[model samples]
Target: MSWEEMLTTVQESLITYWDGLVGSLPKLGAALFLIFLTWGAVTLARAFIRKLGSKTRMRKNLTDVLSMLAGTGLWLMGTLIALAIVFPSITPGKALTTLGLGSVAIGFAFKDTFENFLAGILILLREPFAIGDHVECDDIEGQIEEITIRDTHVRQTDGQLVVVPNHLLFQNPVTVRTNRDLRRTTIICGVAYGENVDDARSVIEAAVREVDSVRNDVKDVQVFAQEFAASSINFEVTWWTGSQPLDIRTSRDQVVAAVKRALDDAGIEIPFPYRTLTFNEPIPVREQGAQDEAA
Candidate 1:
């Protein structure tokens, strides 16, 4: 074709395409408006869920989890709405396929974390131990301070805070000392062998009773004649105290002090270990030269 004819044809084609684009501008604006509405709705729903979660009976961990899930749901919904508005041809099946492919890698990356998360959730639901309860697990003894979605925080007796993964906690044997109404503590005391055992036992029992914090429901303070030691008579004084954080330590100190005072008053001695050594007079050793000269 001639150059002039080709130029005229290109101009007509451009004019027609521009007219079609102008016609669709209103539809595009409406689609954008719909996307904005969907976003606002999702945001409102997330806010409402967060508010309700804080006020509900759910535990702190569960509340956090639920709020996260609600927010994620809103995000996913808003994403889908925007996708539908902008690209009506794309289907959810493609999104599912993409997610399935990514899920395997994500699982491997967070395997331990996922296990702890589930374990924490189960623990929160079951509530085997509450905050401030003394517990022993796998030879690690501590008081629980908080239960989180991935770990349980325990304050050790030595004042160190430990973060234990919930999965291991579930698998191991956990001994909760203060789960009941009262926990017992035993302070073993011994007196001099010459002291009367019955009198010593009575004194220890009275000391246990005098501690105002000690529980009365305890099956009597037992002062058993545990053993006959070389220096002192051993007696076991086991008594119960109310379930308080430091009740065991408090009761123990009180009982030990009282017992010492009582024994001192009665002239019963808490004897320390003693050893008596006797040495025979040795023959005088002579020097080699002196011995030789004497011979």
Candidate 2:
């Protein structure tokens, strides 16, 4: 109960704690060394996975996922081993139980993140699209720059980078524009109603096929009489071309120009909108110069 008795007890307790700490130094050192080795092993595992993935027909994103999982497994095992070495009382069972509970808590906290991750995994597995492929999903049209575990980086045609959650792409309808080497493009070219339908069709088809970008050889150019407009008869000119935005645009420009030139040479008029406005009252109109002079 006295101060001296309390002081002696505290000193003895400190001495025992110091001795225990000194005795456990070797264990701590061993655990640190094991952790260092584990880091090296994880690095090697990732390098090996990447090499194998490249050699095989696996997707790059799937390769990334596999490497990540391998690293995670290695780190988990190493951590358990290190903890057991540092503290002899701790067992693998206890460590795994604690990890499971922590993981549950983390999963609850990051529900959306896990959803995207799972969606990304499915996307990588399904191989619906690939990096550098042009895709459109829910108004986001772009080339797939990268596919990560939680988000996909889309570089839009306008050069804007959009980070979209993988879940949205997985859940929504995605249009892969570059799914094949060739894409079908249709343009309705209208000629004057007085023009010969058969002659106009032949002219348009020949012109479209002549275009540099049009893949008319692989797929025949089709010029069908789609409908009769108020001013002209519309022909739906369809053909195959390169499967890229720029390629499509270039083909369209060339096709339009070639068709116009051919139609002009063939004496076929590409009619403009013919509007006849009916009014209850007629108003006098004057030329611009006359109106200005009158004003």
Candidate 3:
């Protein structure tokens, strides 16, 4: 209970604190070093995969997928190594068990995204349609611009790019318009009831032939008397053109314009709808009565 006793107690406490700090220095340094190495390795792995992706012969979507998958795998491996080095007691088996148990919860939370991811993989592997192919899925129609693990990129005919989930692509019917080398178009024209059907057919066929953008791969340039329409005789002009959907649209416009000019030159009157209105008589307005005003 004196000054010397107090001094002795303070010395003992300082010695214990210093020993504890010295003992913990190695563990702290090891953890820090492992974390730094893991970060550097992950960065390097992504850079390498990005370079590889650029050189790949795969489609743009597939290339992106490969790069992402490779980068993720390398980062995961680096994380596992770093964790094991820093905390040796945490075994890989325990980590796997924990992740497996947690996956069930995560699966439900990300069900839609996971389905989209799986669907994207199927689309890429099956090669249903490649980039630049025009596809109609559900009510959306556009050209395939890019594919991803979760979504598909499309450039619409109107020059807009849309991002659609892959699940939607798989769940709905996809119509690819430009798969074949040629595309056929049907253009119907109506002429007066008494016009020469054979002569009109010949004129229409010649008009179709004059279109330079039209393809010759069609079975035949047929002008059929399809129907006796309400006002005139319907002549069907069917032809083919090997062009992209946008180009097909332009080509169709050209063909239609040419056919219209030819029909005008041939004196074929394309009549409009007719309606007749009949009136019995006009109703006369009655003058107001003075007696009614009084009431």
Candidate 4:
């Protein structure tokens, strides 16, 4: 091409591009202003939802999920409006269609996260185990410390904090130890075979009733003959006490101590293991004086 012709083409192109850019500046500025307004709106919407949640006595975690959802919906609407303004060719409908495909991809990528989120919402609504309720799921034993959208914080009996995914608790069997005011606990107490069965039962029942935490008023102490061991006869002593793990431990300790004392006073023997050894052939034994001389 000729140099003059190339220069003339470049000038026309620059002028056309400059005019287009100048024309787009207003739309860009308006879109930016709209985005700022959207941010303010989102903040206000979340605050309003939280306040309403508080008034309605909703749980903290549930309120958090609701506020997050409200904010997300508002932000999406604002973003769609801004996109429409910035690029008039892309309508909200087209934007939503594109987002739908993108959302499917996102859901697949974060499958577990979404599953846990839904499980958390259901758990909060159902109110199965509240905070401070001691529960055992699978092998985990703990108190419900906190519940979030993704996981639940469990304070174990040993004072360890475990963050467990909500799906596991929702899917697995959960034993709520503190579901009721009192729980029944049993222990195997044994006495010598020579001891009278009726006397031992009476002694164990009396000892369990004497425990400070035992609920003797609500339920009578129970003592049943369980089995005969190598050295002693076992009695299953049962009583009701507080439902917490600590409460159970404390009551068990008190009951054990009280039973031991009662058994000692009644001259009842709590026998230990006994072993008998038999030799098929005789062996020669050295005298103690001969062994000492060799040492």
Candidate 5:
């Protein structure tokens, strides 16, 4: 084609497209207004949901998930409505068909993301553990700080923060330490072999009971001679205490100190490892002068 003919064709196409855009301006404006309206509605709904959650006994994580799902659903509906207004032929069915066709590629590209998202949803629904619960999952043990759509945030005992993927938590065994009000803790105390077993047991039981954090209501404090060790007899002392990790640690510390002092006061020996060596055969003794002559 000649240059003048090509220029004329391009000019005609531009004019036609400009006229079409001008005709659709009102629909475009309505679509934008609808989207903004949906956004405002979503915000209000979220606030209302949060307010309702606070009034009820529902978990914070569940409330957050519910709010997110509600907002996403509303946005999706608004987007479809806007699209249909802009292009009357594009219906929800058609949009879904288009998504279905492209879903395989999208799924492959974002497999882990979707997996975590689904897992997070399941976890929130199950209510296995909540924020501030002390949980040990796989190799991670910490207090749950936050639960998100993709990951969970944990604050470890050492003050380190860990972001754990939700899929791992869902798949693995999780130990929720704070699920109950009380937890049982045990300590092994060894008394010298010469000490009276009954007396040592009594002393340990008393000492553990004296600890302020130890739960005394249940009569769960127990002391039993477990086994004979290499150096001393071991007493297995079990007691109930608060379920928190700090509670267990503090109670244990107090129990240990109290037991040590009580035993020392009672003159009940807590012995160190004692060993004696004996030769199987007698050896001849040689004087220093005799060794020098032999050399």
Candidate 6:
């Protein structure tokens, strides 16, 4: 086609498209307004959810999830309404069908993300552990700082923060250290074989009871001669103390010191490892004077 003819056709097409856009301006405006309206509605709904969550005894993580879900639903509804207003041909059912078909691909692409999300939801619902609770899972031993949709934040003993995937926590065995008010701790104390077992056991039990943190009212202290070691007799000392890690450490330290002092004062020996040498054959020796004379 000639250049002028091509130019004329392009001009006509632009004018037609422009006229169509102008004719649909009202619907476009409505769609934009609906989006804003949806935002406001979702904001109000989230606020209401937060208030409701506060009134109940639900966990903060669960409350956050509920509010997020409500917002998501409201936004989704608004998006469908806007789409329908703009196109006048789209329906919610059709939109859902399209999403269903696309979701397969999306799920495959983000498999781990979806797994963590689901695991987080289950964890929140089951209440296995909560924020500020001390837990040990796999190699992570720390207090739970926060629980989110993708990961859990743990503050380790040394103040290092660890981000753990929710799925790993759900699948693995988690030890909730602070689940109760008291936890049992054991210390192995060894005395010289010559010391009286009964005497040593009494001394250890008494020393453990003297510790401030040890629970004496419960009468949970136990000291038994567990086994004979290479150099000493071992006493398995067990007691009940506070459940926190710091509490356990402090109680153990106090018990060890108290036991050592008590044993020393009573003249009961806490022996060190001893070794004796044996000669398979006799060795010949010459006096220094005799060797000098021979030389």
For candidate 4, report its TM-score. 0.77
Per-residue lDDT of model 2, residues 1-295, tens digit only: 9999999999999999999999999999999999999999999999999999999978877999989989999999999999999988899889999889999999999999999999998898788999999999998999999998899999998999999999999999999999999998889889988889999999888888788898877888888999988988998988889999999998888999999999999988999899888999998887999988998
lDDT of each: 0.80, 0.92, 0.81, 0.91, 0.93, 0.93
TM for every model, in the order presented, reads 0.66, 0.81, 0.67, 0.77, 0.81, 0.81
**Candidate 4 lDDT by residue in tens digits, 163-237:** 999999999999999999999998999998889999988888888888899999998888999998888899998
Worst 10 residues of 1 by lDDT: 78-87
As a whole number from 0 to 100, the lDDT of residue 197 in candidate 2 is 95
Q: How displaced is residue 103 in candidate 2, in Å?
A: 2.1
- Where model 5 places Cα greater than 4 Å from the true spot, the runs are 1-37, 57-61, 282-295
Q: Per-residue lDDT of 161-246 in model 6, one digit per residue for the tens?
A: 99999999999999999999899999899999888999999988888898899997875799989998999999999999998999
lDDT of 1 at 239: 83
Candidate 5 local lDDT, 1-295, one digit each (tens): 9999999999999999999999999999999999999999999999999999999977888989999999999998999999999999999889978988899899999999999999999999898998889999888999999998899999999999999999999999999999998999999999998889989888888888888888988756988899999999998889999899999999999999999999999999999999978999998898999999999
Backbone clashes (count) for model 3: 0
Count residue pairs with overlapping backbones in model 6. Answer: 0
Error of 4 at 8 (Å): 4.7
Residue 199 CA displacement from its true place in model 4, Å: 2.7
Clash totals for all candidate models: 0, 0, 0, 0, 0, 0
lDDT of 3: 0.81
* RMSD (CA, Å), each prediction: 6.7, 5.5, 8.6, 5.2, 4.1, 3.9
